[model samples]
Target: MKTALTELVGIRHPVVQTGMGWVAGPRLVSATAEAGGLGILASATMTYDELAAAIKEVKSRTSEPFGVNLRADAEDAARRVELLITEEVRVASFALAPKKDMIARLKDNNVLVVPSVGAARHAEKVAGWGADAVIVQGGEGGGHTGGVATTLLLPSVLDAVDIPVVAAGGFFDGRGLAAALAYGAAGVAMGTRFLLTRESTVPDEIKQAYLARDLNGTVVTRKVDGMPHRVLRTELVDALESAGPVSGLARAARNAAKFRKLTGLSWRSLATEGLRMKRGGDRTWSQVLMAANTPMLLRAGLVEGDRSAGVLASGQVVGLLDDLPAVGDLIETIVADATGILRRLASE
Candidate 1:
């Protein structure tokens, strides 16, 4: 049904397909947009040029409004922000809290700024900086997540921020949408749920693997890099978790090099970014490197189809999902089910 999120983003449905690197690409984004959901392209894994091309491709595929998730701290973040302005994207989403200047720049260009936050403080900070909205993802969310659960964090953020809040984490169905709405959220933002959909770039074999797991199949561990990351409990994940910080440091060092090569970052620039992360309380150099490797690890599973060697960031909702349906079908089912659930609750 129509909610503030739907009207703000100019989409028919209040649901959102969150940006998952290597998973939420042109195909998935366009499909979700066509399906009446606000799909966001994950720009963390793409170069500035690649992101621009993908945005154009999505525009060609559908005229519906969509968003782009950017690395607010990237070296070329300004360039990427410029691309969004030039493309006239409906919304500009940030993986973390964006700089006040960046937020102002986008708002000046008529782009809606929505940053994903894990805590109430972050929501307040972004709202104070003039963000159009905020997406609050709790501890149960996939990828890099905080320790607060959605049940607690959602209302905390809603109470703290005046802007619209989209509840995320541990949400995979109509029941979740209803729960989020009841919590005073404008809508729900889904990551793992959308990544497991038929339109996602995730391999069929891996998608099947995700479908087979129950709620207990997923685990959150700091072993992946240095930060606590939520991922499937594969054999590799187990090995890494047990390896401890030393091993993680070693891996992070190597991955940092690879990331530099892939993203064309100079050593000076990489070290500067690493230092920024470290100063911001990430602590160790390993944690700094892992921050960048997080996207690459997810790409291994999502784009390359290697579950064993890759880190698959997924929400606990994976256990609740069984089938991979087309984006259109999935959105329709969710909207209809949510409507029915709301009506039933009203009657009660």
Candidate 2:
């Protein structure tokens, strides 16, 4: 399982448990790290103080190296970057492409920067900006995503970037991992796959719901905000889809205010972030305010165990997941299965 990712990040397996908001906490991160996989704590949903505490908590739980996924657009992104440098984290992962200056600062401190991208162009952008590695997720992934499927996106990114590329989106098993490697990827990154694992903090009832789904169970819609997000087709999702943009925006605004209050984001900071989102051309002011709503909405279903009012951000792979094994067991199973698959393919 040794590859550039494992060697660079000092993990035993090439598999990575990516940061999922309100899901990838210290317990899960430590568990993944202990199992020889790279575990990343999702800091996008956390306050600066919370992120700092979580980082320390992970360090106390496991001596193994793990990463922290941060929102590059957060106003305090610079402060968060300093916290990561101060903690000497093994790898710094970004939900979006970090600024060149931020990447330079981490590199200067001898930290590995691996930003997650949804397209080949983004992969090239981050790599050119001096990122040590990149995780390319395709359209089938959970949360914010692009339109290209993994089969097309992974190779496109691999061909475009010289740095190690970790393939994500619709990857859940050893066969998927093997396929990524065959496509010339360094390894595989997973979100929905790990979300259904025993290590995840998602509730049992919700996890069961995810397991019952099949490839056709999930749907991609812009109703979640304005971006094309893939999620399980629940009643709430259907409502949002049918409500049109006005109604959705109203709900999004309420959720945004709630999230702002919960996370202690000031109106000024919220407005500033909104402006950045607008300038990015990926979303509008209304959509930007609603962007903060997603984490809380997801938390309601994932953490509070309420699926009716909460939105569960998921990949199409959720339908394929049937069991919830311990993190250690899951990692070992993936490695063994991948090894067997690779060997069998070689024999053929």
Candidate 3:
């Protein structure tokens, strides 16, 4: 189970429980850490104070190494970086590639930087900027994702960067881990698989809903946030796809306001963040406003357990998952299974 990722983050297993929003809180993270895998706390959905408290809670629950996933483009990105440094977090994983100086600042403080990348060039960019490693997620990943499959995308990134690459997207079992390692990846990162675990705080009904899916149960649509997002094919998702642009924008505006209120952000600050997103991605004003819909909608489904009202972000791997094992049992099984597979191949 030992690999560059294990050595890089000081974890015993090469598996990683992704920092999934609403699901990767202290309870889930601590369980994953106790299981000897890197458990990343998802900070994108939390306020600064909440993140600090969650980090403290994780430390209280387990002393094993873990990471925090951050939104590098957020208005408080720098402040959050400082929080990680002050908290002595072992690793910092970014949803978006952070500025070079941010990478330098984190590295200087001895925090390992690992950003999720969708393409080989992005892996190279972050690697050149001193990222300790990169997690390359493919089109099958949940939420906002690219259009490339991991089988193709993983090798391209491995070829493009010398740093340790963790393969993500469409991975759920020990066999997938063995395949990723065979493909030259240091390890594997999984979001949906971890989300379906027993330690996950997601409501049992929601977990059942995810487990009820098949191979064709998920759909990738841009209606979620003006970007290609993979999610379970729910009635709400179908409605969103069929709705007109004007209606979509109206709903997005309302959600944006709600999100602002929940986060205690000023209207001016929200607008500024929207503008930054627009400029950075060359997105339309409508698309920028639509982007605001993600957090609130996800919160409704994941946190509030409103299946009819909220959209569930999910990877297509949901079809293959049926049981909810405890985090410790899941990781132990994956490690043992992968070891047997690799050893058998070597003996052959």
TM-score on alpha carbons, each prediction: 0.97, 0.97, 0.98
- Summarize candidate 1's per-residue lDDT along 156-213 as a digit string, tens digits: 9999988889999998888889889989999999998898888887899989989999
Q: Which is superior by lDDT, 1 or 2?
A: 2
Candidate 1, pairs of clashing residues: none
CA lDDT, every model vs. true structure: 0.88, 0.88, 0.92
In candidate 1, position 171 carries an lDDT of 89
lDDT per residue as tens, model 2, 1-348: 888889889999999999999899999999999999999999988889999999999999999999999888887889988999999998999988999999999999988999998777888889999999999998988888888999998999998999999999988888888898899988899988888888788899989988988888888878776788888899998898888677777888888888887777888998888787799796766677677768778889988989898888889888778889898998888888998999998999
Judged by lDDT relative to the true structure, which candidate is superior, 2 or 3? Answer: 3
Which candidate ranks first by TM-score, i.e. highest? Answer: 3
What is candidate 3's lDDT per residue for 1-348, written digit by digit as tens? 789999889999999889988889999999999999999999989988999999999999999999999998777889999999999999999998999999999999989999999999999999999999999998998888899999899999999999999999988889999999999999999999999988999998899999999999999988978889999999999999999989999999999999888767678877887888887886888888888799999988898999998989999999999999999999999989999999999999
Worst 10 residues of 2 by lDDT: 282-291
